[model samples]
Target: MAYSYEPHHFEDFSVGQTFESVGRTVTESDFVLHSAFSGDWTELHTNRHYADEEYFGERVAHGPMTFVLATGFVYRCGFLERTVLAFLGMNYMDIPAPVRTNDTVSLDMEVVGKKELSSREDSGLVTIDTEMTNQENETVFSGDMKFLIKRRD
Candidate 1:
């Protein structure tokens, strides 16, 4: 059966649920814009000559950029649309592979935990495991994210 995502409610999420995202190819403009926006002007992420001389042999995107992309992908999946209260935190973040410019990336997530908030009956906490991969199926990033999810009235 095609899994139907539920109405805005804390009970919608369950352990082991996974979501996949549409692909987005990282470009030079994306790399530059993020570098400028975040003030992360690292040579590896911004300078081709420096990056080419380094171990990875080419310019790579910032890790934070990938993080933003993954989060945006989750939103794009419509999993938490109008249902999220606030971002809690993240843990176990890892960049397993290089995120080079021009590499297409996709995100996937799995729900790991859920708990009702003691302070708020209309919301709950959720933990998710996220992985981002490149066109070659190499894992570029992995991490856990926490969110405060709102329930319907």
Candidate 2:
């Protein structure tokens, strides 16, 4: 089914609403660039030779990179566009599986909870359960993300 690219406000969200994002292929360039940008040129993510000897048996993308890409995929869905006031925070983030080069990943987001902000009538908080899965349907990352979203009223 075709997904809409329209923004969704706080009042538009309901518990159990889910969104599936477009897939993105992770690449060597992604690792290299992420390492360079984050100043985290760790051998596990950069040195294939070292990584080849490690538990994963090959270079793995940095954990933060996975989260970043996952969020990007969600943004591409266009639901949070201008309606999102701020990213409050995340909770219980987990990287259960390694994300390697050429792995296509997609994000599955479900609205788990919502709370009206007594301090701000113009906005509210929405909590979503996020799981990022690879092409093989293995969960690479999971977390709960909270966002302050604008209210339509």
Candidate 3:
């Protein structure tokens, strides 16, 4: 059954319940704009000559750029629209691989933990295991994100 978009109470998420988001392809324009916006002039992100010799044969996307993309994908999945009160923070983030141009990246998430906020009865904390994978099914990014989720009475 499709998960409803209604506000999911703190009890809605199970420790292993997982959800997935639609995929988005990385385009040349994504790289160009990201590079310019963040001023990440690293050779791996720009400068083709440096990348061709030092790393992958061609320019690669910035690691942080991929991070942002993953976050956006998760939002598109449902959490943000359904139950999110606010984005608390993320922890143990790692980008173990590069995301190259034309790669279709998708988002997946699992509810890793849940905790009632003693100070807030209207909401609670949900810890999610978030991952971003490329078209080749290689994991490019992984991390834990905590969200303030509304409680349903």
Candidate 4:
């Protein structure tokens, strides 16, 4: 089945709401482009030979790269398309495993909290717990994201 791509308002979300995204493989080009764009050509992310001597045993994708990709994956799910007013921030971000080339990744998101804003009647805050997992179902990145969502009322 195809994704819904429907935008959801604040009132449409609940504490137990969840979403899953389609898989996207991490590629060598992703590494190269992200390294160039982020100006983070660290040896661990750019040099295979150097990374081989390190604990991870091979070059790994940058933490920020994985985070960005996770956000993109969630975006593709389309629940926040036009109803999201702003991205407040993230909390307690953690990377539990390395993301290597050819590792297919997907995102799982669940709404953990929702609060109406006293200062703004048009929007409310929604907190989502996000996990980005690789093909092996190992969580490579995880965090809580807060967004200001437009209320239908």
* Candidate number achieving the greatest TM-score relative to the actual structure: 2
In order, candidate lDDTs are 0.84, 0.91, 0.84, 0.91
Could you give candidate 4's per-residue lDDT for residues 1-153 as a string of tens digits?
445558889999999988888899989999999999999999999999999999999999999998899889878899999899898998779999989999999998899999988999999999999999999999999999999999986
What does candidate 1's lDDT look like per residue over 27-49, in tens digits?
88888889889999988887888
TM-score of each model, in listed order: 0.92, 0.96, 0.87, 0.95
Cand. 4 TM to true fold: 0.95
Error of 4 at 38 (Å): 0.7
For residues 15-80, write the lDDT of model 3, one tens digit per residue. 998888778899989988998899877777777788888757888888789889988877776656
Which portions of model 1 miss their true places by more than 4 Å? Answer: 1-8
- The numbered model that scores best in lDDT is 4
Worst 10 residues of 1 by lDDT: 1-10
lDDT of 3: 0.84
- Candidate 4 — which residues are off by over 4 angstroms? 1-3
